[model samples]
Target: MPESNNCCEAQGLDAITAKSHMDESIKPTEPSLIQQVIDNPTGDGITDTNLRVPEGCPRIDPCPAKAAIQTQECETEKGDGDNIALERARNAPPGPLGPVPTGHGENVPLEYWTPLGDLTGTRPAVENFSLSRFSPNEWNEHNKKLSAACHDGIQVATTAGFNALCSISRAYAEADRNQMDNNIRLSTRAGTIHRWTVELERMIADIIEEIDLVQEVRRRTMRVKSVLQVVENIDKDMMRIRCFRMDNDLVRDQVSEEVTKELSLCEEIRDVYIRLLDQIKMQIEELITAKRRVEFDWSEKKEAYEIETESRGLGSQSDTILWKAGSTRIPPDQSSPSGYEYSTKQVLAEGYTAKQRSSTLRVNVDAMIEKAVKDLRDQADRVDLTLTQQIQLQEQALRRLEAELYKDLQQLSDTETLIDEMHDASKKLDGAMKCAQTRLDKRLLRHGVENCRDVPQFGLIEEVKSLSESVSATLGQLKRAENSTSSLIQSRRDIEKEMVVKRPVILTVPYYVCDRRSYKSNAQLEIQSP
Candidate 1:
């Protein structure tokens, strides 16, 4: 068998030599190839070649051809015998600390499966299982080396695992802290936005209330204006009546004069009402503008509240929480925090100012309305009182004139009767004179001495003269009585004409002014409270 092995080895060597020479002859010769191999012995550089031998270097140890041939020849020559030998080698017991392998083996605990005891300085009972050829010291040293390597590997793995756990735990803790901080910030921001929303709501309410009040004041102004206009018209009518009086009757009487003054007062009141109405309208406009601003601000606050609430709802792990494009960048027209606060403050301030002004305007309007009504009422009362007094005086004068007229009429009748009686007496006297004259004429025919100065003729002449003077006195008295009657009639007519001019004024003032007052009171009641 040894001889056959030697023969196989020689044949394998010769075959390798011949094959190598043949490959060398077939390939191209390059002088730099040797230098390339020398520079990169493992061919692990830029080149793809593996380890190479120089031209004159010895052949590689454990030649592949020699081993192959040896293995094949041995198998051909003794197949069953080689199998028995291999099985026997496998069944052999290992040494104290396990088998000392010379090649790569299974990665398992060979010492645990085989032996874990000290080496004995004794031979094995079976020659095939003997470990006499292997030095115990060397096997122990190998076992110790392998155990140390495994322990070192385990220690390294454990340390790396612990460090990885600590690093991961720290990362989780940092993420939790970050999330907590973000939540706190969101909560604070939402709270601030909510507060702003509440403030806006308050401002809006104030503006709305102001607007309502302004509207109410406007209505009141209109009502007051209507009342003033009515009063003014009545005064104008009274003045017109006075103006249309007859030229002689257009005297500046107390009633007419007072009517003119009342008209002027009415006109002044009307002008005041007009001014107040204008002011009310302007105030309404301001209130409306302020309300609009408050509403706009309230809308902004509402939107901000929603946005903040939504933002607060987002979480790190939420699917909806995503990266927004350019989210970190500010808009061009975006206001800063201070500017935003200032703008909000300005809106609130304007609304507050409008509310204050509205309140003040309302107060002024109320005061003006009260004053105007009071003034007009007072003036009307004064005029009514003066007219009543004047009417009473005129009435008294008419009564006196009537009484005087009656006396004058009676005196006139008595004077007329006396004049008639005096006329009759004159007639009788004329008859007596005629008869006496006839007697005297007859006597004169008898004797001129009988017509001479007799006592009877003298008495007849004196009686005729007395009767003539009484008739003339009666005529004078009758003329004076008729003149007095004419004067009394003229005074009564004047008093009646003056009463005609004044009676309508007294009627108009109290009734119309009272109606106006009632209307104003109703209007005030109808107005809504702010």
Candidate 2:
């Protein structure tokens, strides 16, 4: 077996040498183990042994002679027992523990094996053992690294979640704040509206109050006007009465006329004059009462105003009182004795003096009597002057009354004619009133009011003036109130607008991120649960 192996080695070397020379010009091609085995089966039992050859060789195509010889030789060698040896070598258990079956051993080059030893058993158990054995620990370390990475991812995810939550919360807060701001604005508007409304109401109330006061003042003014009108009418009637009184001859002539209409008219005029006088007297009394009341009120107001003005240092000097008789003085009286009284006084003095002694008497009786006379004359002249002044005043008053009486008489005649016409008109008016009253009564009866004729006839001119004045004053007051109300409303609108137009601002807000890729990259975990 050793000899056969040696001969195979020698033959392999020769074939290598021949092939090397023959392939010098051709590209060298390495053979696989299977191909080497098929080409040189008889040369070596191990097909992967390196074939040796000489350095130089001729390219000779040896014919069938060398091939037949080599074939016979190979046949004889196989018959000798090489087939059984090759079979035993192929089937033999790998030596010792044998070559570990490395999964890629078939891909190893057969040329890499040696022919001297059983390299099949001697080859490395695994030619290229993977680093997989150490991989478990590496994988564990990798897993730990991965776990750390996953932890970081989870932290990132948590951070992203927190940031997202913060953004959402901020948005929600902003929304809430906006809503709150809106609500506050609305509330503020409502408050402003309410305040304006209240102010308007108060203004309206003030206007109403002012209107009421003005209306009341106007009503009193109307009453005063009516009273004044009545007074004027009374004055006219008094003048008519005076004129009638003055024209006695004319009245008498008219009274004696055949028609008797003037007489009847004069009677009616007299009666109307009397009624008018009474009415005028009553109206005058009322006016006087009213004037007295007004005067009293004015006096009170004036007094109060004066006191206030004085306190305020606004008083007038014209209010001071003065007297006209400040310098008048009366002198002492000097008088003279009568003649018989003087003689008696002298006899008494002589008797008294005869008893005492014979003495001459010194007397100033003449001067005393003269002074008395002068004093008496001055007093008489002063009395005469006073009496004369009083008489002049009386004469002036009487003359004025006489003139007034003459004017009154003249007017009285004219008024008598007017009165006649008025009486005739009154008769016609009475007829009309009766007719109207009858008609009204019929209508009133239909409306269930009985005895409608009991309704009094209204005085025309008096009521007409009173009513007209009342209506006029009332309308004036209404106009003033309307103006005041309009002004108040405009003021309220301005106030409301000002209130609504003023508000405060907000600051310091955050922004949010909404990119999916950034969220995923930063996050360790998926948002959707695995």
Candidate 3:
């Protein structure tokens, strides 16, 4: 009972000490280094002096350590108490000199008296007797208990220490791993930002170069238009000169024809130039639009570079790092990586295509203007030369027509003969068809099963179909032949009328010559008089 009471008293003292420790630990004081680290994990404002533990501060170890220490101290106190008790028993006086009386009738001093036996015949049961007094001293038993408790406490302390160590080590390892991953993420992001910045720079330069080239093309296009305008003015002057002649002299002559042709050529060339200008203008506008997009993207790239660079600068020791709300989440309208790259490529491609087209147009502009001028100056001579050639060809064609007329007349007679032949063949085919049909009709006269299609019946049916088709084809050929005969006769009549109309008269050419000479003289007189 005393041992149990001592154990309970020790536990009560331990609890009181623990409660007092808790209160002491919770007492407000100057901010500790750990609290500082939590508030500013980067340790930006911390110093080596702050790392030293303060005097009188409670130990920073976990709860189990303190509990184990308290248990060991309690066991030591218990052992000390047992030792004191043994010393007291060793120094005490001896027991009584002789055996005391059993009080069943034995003589004994009253000071060592015994109680009377039960008068109702109630005696102690023999089975209830115990030899615990003769077994071992209470002190020895208590010592054994204290020794076992000390051993158990040692095992518990060792296990708790192992668990605490493992937990702390794992925590430190995880923290380091997280830091490494963060560094890698930031580094990779920075590289991406730098690469995009370089690409944007290149795109911007390309767009600017393209813009310059397109402007040059525009200048060339304007110059070509100006040259075309000058050519138009020259054509106008020519037309004006032709108009100055009197109305009678202004008759449609070679000079007037040549001037009109040149004016028309000049107008056509001007129209081409005007359309080219419009195309160049449109190309320039397209290039400008592409340039704007590139510039905008370039600016965005610069901003992204700045942001990434700033992010890379942030370190564990950086004071500026703070929790930014929604920073980890993707924002609305943000483009994906592929979308960004595609848009950039589209912008560059548009610029390149526009610049290439502009260059091609600029190159062709000179060639087109040169060809137009050459055609304009030589067009009238070529026309007069072609007119002469056309007259010769017409004469040749007239002669060839006379020859064709003779051939056509012969062909018409042949066609009439063919038509008669076709009619005769058609009649022959009709007779053949009737003969085959008569055979088929005779075969049908067989009764019942004998009327079935035999070899001869099939042969007769085929013959009848062949003959019918032949007759149909012959009739169609005869009709076409008659049509050809009619067309040939009409062609002959037309040829005869054309030959008569084309027949030259001796006075007609001479009169035409006389009229041309008179007309020329009149025009010359009017010009000379003016």
Number of the top candidate by lDDT?
A: 1
Cα lDDT of model 1 by residue, 364-392, tens digit = 87887777667666777676676677656
lDDT (10s digit) by residue, model 3, range 1-530:
45433432333333345445534544445345445533343446767666444455433322122233245345435654433433443344432211211111111122111111111111111122210111134367667779989999999999989988998899878877887787788778778767766776776677677667657656655665565455455445545544543423334555446646766876787788688778767777876776677678768777887887787777767999888988888888899989977876786676567657766765675566557556753663454354345435446656877899989999998999999888888887877888899999988899999899999998998898888888888888888999999999999998876655443421232244224323542233233221
The regions of model 1 sitting more than 4 angstroms off are 1-172, 253-272, 314-326, 330-337, 374-382, 389-393, 427-454, 457-530
Q: Write the per-residue lDDT of candidate 2 for residues 1-530, one digit (tens) a residue.
A: 23422432443433345444435622345334323433343444542245432244222221222243345345535565434433443454543223222211122223322221121222212223321121243467657768999999999999999999999999989987876676566555445434434433443343344334434433433333343333334333323432332211124232123213322333343443344335334433443343343344334434544454443332223455345584455534522336424543453343333322211100122232233233323432343344345335435644554555455545554554555554455455555556655655555555446434453424433444454555465555555545554554555454333322211000100001112212321131121111
User: Sorted on TM-score, highest at the top, how do the candidates line up?
Assistant: 1, 3, 2
The alpha-carbon lDDT assigned to residue 292 of candidate 1 equals 85
lDDT of 3 at 131: 9
Candidate 2 at residue 294, lDDT?
A: 36
TM-score-best of 1 and 3: 1
lDDT of each: 0.59, 0.38, 0.58
The TM-score between candidate 1 and the true structure equals 0.58
The number of the candidate with the highest TM-score is: 1
Q: Stretches of candidate 3 above 4 Å error?
A: 1-185, 246-251, 353-530
